[model samples]
Target: MNWYLKVLKQYADFKGRARRKEYWMFTLFNIIFSGIAISLDNATGLAQMGVGPIYGLYALALLIPELAVAVRRLHDVGKKGIMLLVVLIPVIGSLWLLFLLVKDSDPNENAYGANPKLIPV
Candidate 1:
């Protein structure tokens, strides 16, 4: 939960490196919350009325933070943020991006900043 909140605090920040733990934790919380939102929408009959309003609003609110954390995660792996566009290629591209995100951080800092793992909490 701390990791998720940390990412939210960073909000739209697209620079710097994010630890793998931070990225994955945020992703986990997002999935859980999305599920909850969808359930709420369904229970309220919002889904039958139209699009799932709650889910749509939740997704919209997190879009920027999601991109920011992903960019930072790529930075941790020593890739440029633009590498995120690789997801556009096709199935292979998304797999490649997933591989990149799952990769461990560079032992030493590159151009992004000092590794999050090395910094004292």
Candidate 2:
């Protein structure tokens, strides 16, 4: 949960490296929260009423942060944050991005900043 909170605290920050644990933990919580919101919305008949699910609202609010974290995660792997644009290429692009995100951060860092996982906390 600290990982998730850390990412949220950073918010729109896109200038640093983010360890895989930080990025993946935040993503796990985001999916969990969104699922809960969607369940509640469905139970309340929001979907039937065309009022939309709370998950949609939550996702909209955090879109920027999500993108920023992803970019930072890419940076952690020594790739330019702009490489995130590859997602726009459909299936292959998204799979490649997933591969990148799951990769270990550069051991010694490569300009974005020190490896968060290697820094003594």
Candidate 3:
């Protein structure tokens, strides 16, 4: 939860490195919340209205932060944040991005900034 909030606090920030915990925690919470919102919409017949519920709006609200975190996470791996565009390539693109996101951060940092995992709390 802290990780999720941390990402939200840094929303729109794409210039720094982000630890895996930061990225994945935010993703996890996003998924959980979206699922809940969708379920609520379906249960309440909002789905019949074609707009579903608030999930679409919530997802829209988070899209920027989600992209920012993903870019930062890629930076933490020593890759350029622009590499996020790889998600447009289909299966291979998504798998490659997932692979990149799961890798441990570069210990000494390359160019983005100091390792978030190594910074003294």
Candidate 4:
């Protein structure tokens, strides 16, 4: 999907705001790909040997991009990227963070940059 590739292209970029579509699409594709990778590792007997090599490698490669997109998603909601740390608190923290991420973006730009929805993309 274009959204998934877009996130990958940005790679480790942690600046700017990412529209909800971008973040959710990336998450969707990441889940699909991870499933495929795990399936491949299991089919190849890699899981029995150790951590599924394919899944492990795939997860490791996407770690930075995942964080970057999440930070950007938080920015879109007008929250500081540091708010991502709230996920470490407990069940409530994760629920709160989910609430923030799903919350609509600020209609106007804040500190991050112009809203992607408002930009003539």
- Overall lDDT per candidate, in order of appearance: 0.95, 0.88, 0.88, 0.93
RMSD of each: 1.4, 1.8, 1.7, 1.4
TM-score (all chains, Cα) for each model:
0.96, 0.91, 0.92, 0.95
Q: What stretches of model 3 exceed 4 Å from their correct place?
A: 48-51
**Which of 3 and 4 is the better model by lDDT?**
4
TM-score winner: 1
Q: In model 4, how large is the Cα lDDT of residue 24?
A: 95
- Residue 53 displacement (Å), model 1: 0.6
Q: Candidate 4 lDDT, tens digit per residue, 1-121?
A: 9999999999999999999999999999999999999889988888965449799999999999999999999999898889999999989999999999899999997999998998764
Give the alpha carbon lDDT tens digit for every residue of 1-121 in model 2.
Answer: 8888888888899998898998999999998888788788888888655435587788898898899899999999999988988989989999999999999989996899988887864
List where candidate 2 sits over 4 angstroms from the true fold. Answer: 48-53
TM-score-based ranking = 1, 4, 3, 2
On residues 1-121, what C-alpha lDDT tens digit does candidate 3 reach at each position? Answer: 8888988999899998998888898999999998888888888888755447477788899999999999999999999988988989989999999999999999995889999888854
For candidate 3, what is the TM-score? 0.92
Greater-TM-score candidate between 1 and 4: 1
What's the CA error at residue 62 for candidate 4, in Å? 0.1
Candidate that scores best on lDDT: 1
lDDT of 1 by residue, 1-121 (tens): 9999999999999999999999999999999999999899988888955449899999999999999999999999999999999999999999999999999999997999999999975
* Candidates ranked, most accurate by lDDT first: 1, 4, 3, 2
Compare candidates 2 and 3 on TM-score and give the better one: 3
